[model samples]
Target: MDAAMFSIGNSSSASDNETVVIASNEDLYSYAERVVAAVICSIICIFGSIGNSLVIIAVLLSRKLHTPPNVFVVSLATADLLTSLFLIWDVVALLSSDGWPLPNAKWLCTMTSFVIFVCIGTSLSNLAAISLNRYILITKPYRTYQRIYSPVNIGLMVIFTWICPNLLSLLLSLTKIVGFGYNRKYFICCHFGQQPEDELLFILSDVLLIFIVLVVVVLSYIFVLKHVRQHFKGKRRREVQGIVMQASTSGNDTERQDRQRSTTAENSISQPDPSGQPIRRRENYKDLQVTKNLLLVVVVFFVCFLPYSFLIIFPRSDSFHLYAILLALMNSCVNPVIYARRHPHFKIVLSAMIKCQYQNIPEPTGIAKRFFSRGINPIL
Candidate 1:
């Protein structure tokens, strides 16, 4: 998309660009390169589709996964699923041996591009939402977290993540501001607006969107880091002060008192604290672990997505642009590895699905229960 946008928005002569584009398509990706590209896209699409489906299905079926954050995970999976489905068509268009397999179905290709763009945009939005959720959960009061991440609010956020992309893409297309269509430059469907000024504005807007997402994600993690560091620092300081006071008081004690003190210390270490501090510490530990896991998701997301966004600003060779597109598409595939393979309940349930271990599994309620209610249902 960025490649097409750059090629289309360039001030060069259209005819010259077309000649160069057509020549470059044949020259750039040879038969071997094309096959490799196809294999990569196929893997991304197949695994991405299946993995994300498992995530959604796991959440739907497993009562344990019905958390506020998993709502974001499902939303993310939904976006990736649409992306994985569209990518097969995307690669087919770009890698076709014949010029455009469907000569008469240009609109179909355009629609596919639109869906791809929207789904990708939605993925970014969902990531941003997840970052915000993490920030609130880590830094805010328990009641405040509960209030903000309540089911009604989560539903609204899921709605926002999906709706925001659709609206933005529609605005671009309806206004003819960010033209997304066939780019002969790389034999890929991408952007090039009719009006240069409008295209420039669209580019600026896209940059701003990228900037916003970056800011939200970066700042959220930064704040979480600060909070965690300060919390542990204060805790260590208090422990040090307590030790100092204890030593000062014990300095006047006899050898028998010292022996008794050592015994008391061992006993205290062995016994669990009756105070709520241990429980609070445990909660903090759990939150920190969760934050780290989601941080992995965010890191993978940016690694997959940033190159494409960078290429948009600094337009590169056809090969680089294609590489960027592939990397961006891969963002969809990598999330499920984080969610399904790494997430606790998600791993268990998805592993069960893989092993066909439904017999011992407690009957899940809602969708899975209904779907599996009648043996060999017609929907199967």
Candidate 2:
């Protein structure tokens, strides 16, 4: 974001009092802050728009990227894409010289608030689903994995990710209840902190629920990593030291894992499946890479969403409002980078598409291996 400063365009008369001048100076500083925020949002919007679109296009163009996990990636990219597209309204609200909100845009702003809320929720939901998928892949038997992640089931999960969030957001918005309003102070949508309900509702419905979901995500990944660890116990480490940090519920537990992992790192490279074990270790490693990438996404999600959720639960200085909004916007922008740099196959497909070399694109890799593998398995 350019550090370019901004000043209100209105000019003052020479006869204005000293108090009026001082007030104008303060107003100028506040407006300047908003301008900085708007600039940062503009940058995020540009990257998110282009990057997320590329993800979708890459998946569509090269079906090789299609898998149960990429299904979530594409779903997430779609949510982030909506976020990038709709977030412009907030930017406009910040930069506009007119009053906080033009009355004419009320319904539009409400809809914008609704969309942003849904996208945030959808993104979290998809991350949780991804974590559960990883949990099953690592811990459960192949037959169990196939039964749970069948095409019909994957379709159901994706549908739940989108439809559930939309329904919840719509229900909240229509009721004119908490977490949805036209923010007057910032002249933006996504009006949180307006309707504070009771404590249980606050915990179950808002920040506490978000906190629980995050903990669940972290714990699920920890379990998957731990299961994979049993497979690699006692292997000689000939590679450079790569970190696979682990978190635990207790401080002592965390320190123990850190000490244990200090000397070893899980290799994400493809390797053969264990002898007599049917689950493909090569694809399992790919799944691990995808999980690692998404775990980072979840961490980012925690950082971005927590403050805003806290603000909703416990309101403080209004100054942090715009900053919180901007932080939330960053989540939409970071995923594409994480996927391109971290995922195994995404970068290859994405690079070819970006270079405009269509012929170089790999052949379409169909759905998740078991979702549509050879020699038909019963759907049930």
Candidate 3:
């Protein structure tokens, strides 16, 4: 892991002043700025690595978290981990120097740029897969369990997400088109070139990819919210009806007693009241609500990814520096926080991981085991 970190760190600062970025000529001042950037990057990379590493470990060790969605989450964390260690670390190193001091080679620079870009793309792709998964589960229930939990299907989706972006980045890198003109003033590594068309292609591909993912994510949440609201609303009504029925029954019983005491001349046998009607409506409603709440995972995906979309696509000379970096870095920190917030079980799991007091919880049955009793299900 340390080796991998160093390799990526070495790659990050491979490019310098030749990229045509914001200009700053002061040597000492530049050194201070680069130091600060490295510190920030190190902090983010260290914590991000620890958190994502825990996710992978917990999923592997604890049978409970090894579900289809967690599978994608593992991928997401893996991609982010690579980006922070490799690209962000490089950026930190470059902020001080005008250019890469190490051996400069065409292939090295190209490979470094390619690797860093792919890592970013992979993160977005995994998120998109997650959103699509949630959408299917909520919107199309009959097929959800069958298609979603299949190991074959899940594996393919993961592979597709990982592979597609590198292919896209390869095409972009080959063009030798620099998108954003020199941004030497603030940071380094993977800064776009001056060619508007090249930059536009890169931006379009990124936006298109992210935009699709965000759309699916947002739409999934919207459906989830609608379903939950209707369900809870029905539950509230049923609860009220139940109370009214109890009151009415008590009143009837009292009246019957009063009649019997007042006029014993006509004794009447009483029959048991019919069984209370089944609360099928309420049960269905509750199911919908629970399903919707689960879809919050998709919401997290959108929130983590949105800033990068807006910042990258719309480059501005007057852009805010800290804000841009924050938006990018937020993607690194958001996942663990979201998992902790939304999944109560995950909080306990994450805490256990942090304290190094991991317990052996029996693996929850796989999704397929729960729903598919006898036969294999196909998902294409």
Candidate 4:
């Protein structure tokens, strides 16, 4: 192997008769850390697999959650689950041994790396689509249901997200564009000796994917807040107008009644108020506060996935190790917490799922029906 081509590890070359192996980075703390990572990864894989499975089940079973956003979430959960599955092996293998045990099957490492890349990329892009969908829903809510959330658009988004990254990864893998060239008896593992072009492609894709997702998330939330503000303002104006109309109608009736019974007008005027406008306003205020809490949930989702993007773009950077660990573990750690915090409905559904006591399943519609039925219109 040319030292200049791949500078990651300092493994001295071996003669043709000798077997090549990279020297292991072993230390007491490293060993302990590896064990910790493995444990964490295992926990994440277990919970993530269960939680995402439950999510998919709940969506399938519940008619009420048959919305575009929920569909997107289902896709997201699948991506996360797949990522956790692919990543957990590396964690376990690392803790058990310093190198991949199956060096004979070099393509396994390559395929594993490719799968990881695809999952993470698809997950990030799906998230971006979700954010954009939310933004459209809030900003142009009236037309949202008909246009943006339509089966065709959602299908296209899914296909776009899934195909692009895999294609890129496939090209890189086929040409050995990212890893060391064919002559180099380089070890094929999660961490590979990458070329500059390979590094640039990987980093660029990671950065662009993350940047766009974050931008969508941030801008979507901002617009959602603004939309919520406007919504409340319009509602408040309506309430005020309603109050004025009620007061006017009541005053007109009172005047007419006074004309008929002048002697008892003072007594009628002393009657207490019947309508509870104050109570209604308080309830509306409470709902507004609840919406704010929901916004916090959305924020949590973005924050939890943020580190994974950093890891992808700066794979060689110092932060990669810690962030990759977090990314692997976060799929199971974040969603239930976010849902419990933001949406009471999700909790109820989740609880039902846990109890194995589900309600009557809703008839699947749109993309979901298409998904489960496997019938695709040729035009699409």
Best by lDDT: 1
List residue ranges in candidate 1 displaced over 4 A.
1-20, 193-199, 241-282, 359-363, 366-380
**CA lDDT for candidate 4:** 0.55
Question: Candidate 2 residues 1-380, lDDT tens each?
Answer: 00010111112313233335335434543777879888888888899998998888778756777678778889999999999988788788777655445677666677788788788888888988888887877767668888998999999999999898788766654553445545534656663432333333433455655776787798898887776665454233322223323333235666676655544333323322232223345445566777777788888888988887766444443456567778988989888888788877887877766665555667744432333345332221
**lDDT by candidate, in order shown:** 0.71, 0.67, 0.55, 0.55
Per-residue lDDT tens digits for candidate 3, residues 1-380, read 11211122222444343232323324223566557666767767777776667666656555667667678889988887776566553554355354443434434444555566687778777766765665455444434555666999889988988899877765654554432212344444554543444556656766787777677767766765565455445546555655555556565777765654433221111111122122232224434443444455455545655666676655552244434554576566566766665564566666655654433224524543332343332110
Query: Residue-pair clashes per candidate, as listed?
Result: 0, 1, 12, 0
Output the TM-score of candidate 4: 0.71
Model 4 over residues 320-355: C-alpha lDDT tens digits?
445454554465446655554455456666665565
| lDDT of the structure predicted as candidate 3 | 0.55
lDDT of 1 by residue, 104-137 (tens): 8877777777888888788789889988888877
Error of 4 at 184 (Å): 15
TM-score of 3: 0.70
In model 1, the Cα lDDT at residue 337 comes to 84
How do the candidates rank by TM-score, highest first? 1, 2, 4, 3
Better of 2 and 4 by lDDT: 2
